[model samples]
Target chain A: MSRPAGKSKLVRGAQGDWEVVIGMEIHAQVTSKAKLFSGASTEFGGAPNSQVSLVDAAMPGMLPVINAHCVAQAVRTGLGLKAKVNKKSVFDRKNYFYPDLPQGYQISQYQAPVVGEGKVLVDLPDGEIEVGIERLHLEQDAGKSLHEQHPTMSLVDLNRAGVALMEIVSKPDLRSAEEAKAYVTKLRTILRYLGTSDADMEKGNLRADVNVSVRKPGAPLNTRCEIKNVNSIRFIGQAIESEARRQIAILEDGGKIEQETRLFDPAKGETRSMRTKEEAHDYRYFPDPDLLPLELDDAFIASIAASLPELPDEKKARFVKEYGLSAYDAGVLVAERETADYFEQAAKGRDAKAAANFVINELFGRLNKAGIGIERSPVAAEQVGTILALVAEGTISGKIAKDLFEIVWEEGGDPRAIVEGRGLRQVTDTGALEQVIDEIVAKNPDKTAQAKAKPAVLGWFVGQVMRATAGKANPQVVNELLKKKLGV
Target chain B: MSVDAATVRRIAHLARIAVEEGEVEKLKGELNAILGFVEQLKEVNVEGVEPMTSVTPMQLKMRADKVTDGGDAAAVLANAPQTEEGFFLVPKVVE
Candidate 1:
């Protein structure tokens, strides 16, 4: 993928002008039933220490047993990103000392990562941008260190320890805050569609370590600062903008930007330096002596590729070309795999454009307001199909169909039955509609005279007639009758 | 593959290590030996070979996104080197 052309001078320091260089390392938790090395349930919300297994807790003499399912998920995720999946990979010990990290070092991928060289297409307001994927490596997450519960003593939760994490590194291709946010969003959508990870930022299931630096346009990249573990998309954008401006300001003055690791203060919307940046050797990374190199064959890689589902980009393109959906509509439907599936099933054997409109505007709008996912929608795909069927057969007008949708959402009944039971069926009888229009025109003679003189005033008469019949009157019949009665 | 003394010192500084000047020569030799071993990897025809990131080619396990109680603040702060008002306290840098 081509990188965005650099424009606008971002130079901040006194000696020379500069441009901002940005890259990201995102760690996403894999969606699996058990921990990476143990059969301990990967269920969240258990009491502290309840979810910990012997291996997870790093009990004496407990050897790590690699979970096969976690491996498959990693392969699936790599394939979903269109990355090269290495048949064989190795685990190394990334030595570091922190309260949350047990065993004094984390077992992670180093020199040999399982996946390599992929691209993610980020949809911006202007157009779609493809960001290059440097690599996606697997590692185990450390436990949480709780510092807020007590005034004097700190506690640790081992629940997250030994959980699998895929550290996806991206090339320094992003230029603006919007692009960075879009990149993460698109990556999350892809991961979710692959069924490999939940990519939930709230639960720390997905987090980003942003690398930011500022330099003159076309100048050598500045020493970048690493912002660690930003968990929200909004914060990711804020951090990039604030940090870039901060660098620009510092350079505009006489000071130099320091290379360090920083943390984003979401409340303040600023990035504060945590510590000086550490090089690869700082962690003293070495091949883990306890574990052996993993080796696989072509057959394994082929099987993983075969099991791969349609990715987000592929589905979006299909929706555009095959279903005749607008880019925006296609994007909305394909953002979530389940939502896309719901739309496809609802649109089956129906007017594709109409189905797209109903699914995107009406159904999705209602679902968003109700705070429900497509999977948990009260209006099932089959029910939507039924509703669209009714509309297609002209049994109910579009206006009445919307009313029936509300009834279906609340009562969870058949669309046809709801329309019949509530007597909300469209009044297609031209005579009845004409009679209602005549009565409305007779009651408002002055308005009818004005409408006859000005043809645009026909909507007023149509509204009055529809209101009299409680919106059940067929709109086409009412319009025709109103035009005839007014004699424009 | 041999790392020079200056390169060793630079790496140490990058890693935030307060290495004594006298030890730079010794560390340089050690680093050189390590890099020599790593250089052997280049000899193998890995033109089409992909880099490995993890053993067993597995993903890290994840949990459902719902937020649960991260547990009591007091319990978490117990391990802090210093604390005040239920938050970790580093040396105050500003007034």
Candidate 2:
């Protein structure tokens, strides 16, 4: 149940059923301060060329040196993915021409990469699926090219040029859009947990290239089209669906699928061909003459391995085992690093399930409604813990806890102090609750007689009593007192 | 192992080199000679040797992850063919 499987069924098309196969090549910017080869800053949104170094600009006679921190970050990420760290890997030059690539070629790993085969356990709604990783490599990123900024000219920004990027490639194990989405999502979560990359799709720190191909069910893989640079997970899903349908249409129409790179037009919900003037698809990769093969010893691998943090998979398991939360709740909470930390802080010394419920159902729901992330959540974890404490100790009824939460969300205050200052505590005193219940029972004599006949009618009286008490009456006490008064 | 006339033109085009129609035949002969000479080096029988990417045995040097070199837009773009507002301007290239 927790293993990787292809869940995508064959799509029934005009002629027959077709299967969609997808693989991903994710380019994640390394969470580092400088470029891969120079001291240039890797900060986002800097002034154009401000972060560019002479080496990054590719001035004549300039050389590139590896950034040790970036290498360590990549190795850490590979270890987190359970990938094998290659003892020696060579840097190769992928030659091409583009205005953004002033160097006329990009430094990439072709013949050998730093990391080898591994598997990432992706959690889907149905179950956990493992996505096979092909390899992870280190490369330098090209600069940004803005084409629409000028009518007849383009502008280039080299701030991102020469920045370190981990090209994590996945085996063609995906079978559906949902699986692709889950794979990218789980990969992003793992990256965030490892602290290798910020993994923010919106910030362009993480991008994915999706490969989509369709064939008759269970047939050998067919011609696959590469969709370049789909940024968001939703777009990845859309791209796969559109590309699969297009290929199926082509195959049904007896037209061969062209193996070429295409782009996903998100606004139009379709993919268009990137028709470029080129002679065969040739990148002419060769070993970079300037850099030597990277060699990592056992000590180096062990050091990075020791520094590894508990990733999402282990964290989810620990959450379920330690906090006794539902597997679903643990999965949800541990999907992101901060949410898990938030849950741990809020669940400390409290009813763990109760805390999990409120954190997931109440707090997360509110955060989603407010369109905010847990990092920016206004409600503090400690406040949540305090609220749960209040509910657990019967200091406030469950209904009053919501009001308390809203009050804290809208305006900050101490939960205990707010309960005291606003007189919002549950009416747990037996005399007061009984008095309220007696009044309710007296007002509804017919209903009270009915309650005597059917004990279930006691619920109506409880609701009436709670409504009369402004939802602050302890429901447990109210139920007990009402049952006694009804003599049922 | 050998270069043809068409292959010479294609190689010249890929390298963005401007070669004349009359020069293609000469360039092809020269390229084939170079390949033939390189092929002769393959005759060496020594097998227990290591492939080297560099002339030295020093490991690849790595620098600290620090912002110690940038922040000079003018110097960075000093040799650009065109510039505006700290960005390099070129003929529009769209994908």
Candidate 3:
């Protein structure tokens, strides 16, 4: 596999040769029924303000009750990334004033987070890549600012306010746009597989703040620029590429890249400076007066770890070794948690290779074309299993099995029943096939002479017999009978 | 633990506050008071304690290597402060 070219350029600076150091801070929403500190539904697409609770809306007298499920999900997410699960964590008040933030300060893990020191294995075309996960911290999300609906005044919707978010931070490890995109993709996959967070970038469930810098090869790191609130994976790559190139051009033109927070304009395909980056003290982060320090036992951490499901990498490896699938196929199947589950369920008690082909090539292709998910697929696991069973039992040819799948997809009937009802079962009776071949050979003596001269032309006779049998004749048996009849 | 006036002004500016010069001293005093309370964390013996990242310990979740719907440019830019012909508009700073 080839590595993607570096987006930033090496240049001579006032401080001498410089190198780029990149890190990322990703905010992923926790998958749970309630908000971080309230019993309100965390479901998206609710009526504005309907999801907000007293705690979520920052009511003065209402106290926050931490959702245990959200915490469990955060811990599960840490374990999935192979991070250290800290038994004790603290929620601190990050003081800031914004119309979108109903609470004067955000309740976020500051000095301490629940998980630490993990690594994500990103699969690059060159080889397997490992991106260091610095920490996975939890915090409540702020509300949204609706600026367009009202021209003079901005309206705030607290629906997302107080919802739990896990800010997974990474070390300065990624080198190119492709790697950055792969890292986010892999992180989302792990989060989904753990069932901790939905990791939906579009729903505002997951977003990445990309940190990029430029320098000379193998030199000390240079001042970095952070692109904020990039919500899509493609934009993440585009931002990194354009930001790095912009920095390179600036340096090449004898200018310095400022340490600032920037925003990616996907339309313009460039990153614009937002503001100078602020340090921690700027937020006036301090322990919250309302919440107490969270304390847990070692056994509690161990229990959360024990409950984690098989992650993507582990499932991918198992798919390859157990099911005889290619590494690429395994990667595709295990990319989504639900798709992996669907494949495993479909492959049960069937030829693994055939089942994998059907799932990846036929089923996934159809789902992609129809813009549906594997979970919402019209074809069920048992239905696919039945189709495979028919092919296995020699009741239908592989070509016919595809047609059967379409029938099952559209008409919604049993696979075996459809094959039987349509009389599409393969004609395995060698005697009947021989009789047909004998008739064809006698009827077309000239063709039989030509076939004897060119034995490869026997395929024409096989096709004729298949057409004669309405494509119900087994292809292998037809070929065999044609060969024996023509004596070639 | 008293925060200096200069440090307070810098912090305020970094945080995007348009604070008046005379108000810096009062803000400094209040920040010092807050910092003094947070200093209590230094007293706890956390020598062997790992830094926590989340409230409940968990791992990162994984998603599939497939593309979701992100091609709609008009829908994405619809919420921007100012936009022109499918592009976000910002004040021109460069000549």
Candidate 4:
């Protein structure tokens, strides 16, 4: 990981420039069928309290049991992050009181999390930045307290209360919001690729708690304020920017910054103080008595490592090396798993550069306009591959290939059938092109004379020949024949 | 690790327990006695021993990932103090 030296991302304050430091604690719900400690279903959008189990609701005499699949998923995630998997980790009780938390104490990992230190490589325009992972802990999620359902009473939804969440904490290595967003995006991609978490922010499966603090250049770490539960990537960046500015304003006015928790109001584009340091809860954390320490053998870790799929970074490098693609194009194509797979299947035994160009430039551009993901693309990889083979074989001109692409996109069918049905193949025969060039040369004697004077004027005759052939003429043949007939 | 009256009051407030003024001294004494008993373990000087979280020395019980329960909303909400429209009604929690 290379950091561009001496490039300071600082906020200009009333006094001087201040550098803002950012770290994120992202909570991604693990992909599983049941809750972490209970056998209740973990489906989303269930009726209020419908998914609550006896253990989840804190009923009397209900002892919590750890879900084996959730543990395996967390271990797989830890390996994917290149983090240390602790053999002996304990579950601790984080005591607190809220309507959402029925147990009055959340079962979480405190001193001994399952995953130890790790690192994520975030790709930026300048270079790569490595964000250090502090730890990854397994914890149960709290229920939802709906305040709007009633005028004076809150409704509690326990569907998500006992769901398992993996809290991935990053070191304060990010200096800008762009780096922060990239970090989250890369992390989410890795999780999705691992099949550990879906990481859908819209469904509340993923959320970020952003920590923002500002300090002068080369100064010690200052007091940091945590912006809690920022759901979207766009809003995470906005929250960091606004929180850093708020801290800088305070420090510039000779006021000491206090460490506290704040909330980001997306509507106002500002962060307001939710709780001060004085009101901060002292969560008396102690190991839970009901559960024993998790012990994993070497075989378990090895199995998980063997089961890991090829990650984005590895796939991008392979694409660059195997297909001889540019680094930028490879990065773009390999950013999403489905897109990369699509490109690999399309580029097989065909013109790799042409396949890459079609996928990146034409297909991506149309997909963007239509607001559809590559998974829902109208054009299949096999169809695109066939079209590229046609272009490579010289059966269709590049212009004809574009028209064919449109036909295949709007009206899905075999590319060969469409090309045969529409008679869109290129006219590469010199005899056919010669007659058209002759007609154009006779019609435009003045342009022909200009072409004879300056060879650059040959483009005019080629344009006329192409127009006469309805853009189906081979452009290279048209240029050659036009120059021969016009005596350029 | 010492528990005083003021500390007991603060803890009660943090836990949202309604501790009366007359009960503060008794609660503090009771908490201090509990802590006093726990402190005796520190004198044993078990320097090389691991800190134990559970009484039983075994791995945590793992369950297969299956949704074997849930979907009975009425039975799940049967014990709620107040129910309205299949939801547990509590005091409005303002964030």
Please give the CA lDDT of all the candidate structures: 0.80, 0.90, 0.79, 0.89
Off by over 4 Å in 2: A1-9, A449-455, B43-49
Ranking by DockQ: 2, 4, 1, 3
How far in Å is the alpha carbon of A173 misplaced in model 3?
2.3
Query: Candidate 2: deviation at residue B76, Å?
Result: 2.5
The lowest-lDDT stretch of 10 consecutive residues in candidate 4 chain A is: A1-10
DockQ, per-model, please?
A: 0.08, 0.83, 0.06, 0.77
Chain B TM-score against the true chain B, each candidate: 0.73, 0.86, 0.74, 0.81
Models 1 onward score TM values of 0.82, 0.96, 0.80, 0.95
List all candidate RMSDs to the true structure: 6.5, 2.1, 8.5, 2.1
Models sorted by TM-score, best on top: 2, 4, 1, 3
Candidate 1 C-alpha lDDT tens digits along A1-488 = 13534354243445554556779999999887777776666677766655666666665687776777777788888888888888767889887766566577899999888888888888877787778889888899998777656655566667788888999999999877778888998999999888888998888999999999876676667778899999999999899888988988887777898778889999999988775444443677887766666665788889989988888899999999998999999998999889899999999999888998999889988998999878889999888888998888878888887888888999898888887887877888998887787788788889988986799899887788778988888788788777777887
Per model, how much of the real contact set is kept?
0.01, 0.88, 0.01, 0.84
For model 2, what fraction of the real interface contacts is kept?
Answer: 0.88
Candidate 3: Cα lDDT at B48: 90
Q: What is the C-alpha lDDT profile of model 4 across A1-488, one tens digit per residue?
A: 12322355677788877888888999999999999999999988877778988888888899999999999999999999999999888899999988889899999999999999999988888778789999999999999888887999999888888899999999888998888999999999999999999999999899999999988877888999999999999999999999998888888888998888999999999999886545666999998988888899999999999999999889888988999998889888988899999999999999898999999988999899999999999999999999999988888988888888888989999999888888888899999988888787788888877877799888777777777888889998888777667766
Stretches of candidate 3 above 4 Å error?
Answer: A1-22, A59-63, A276-281, A431-468, A483-488, B1-95
State the lDDT of candidate 3 residue by residue for A185-299, as single tens digits.
9999998888878899889889999999877776567778889999999999899888877887788788887778888998999988775444533577887756666666778
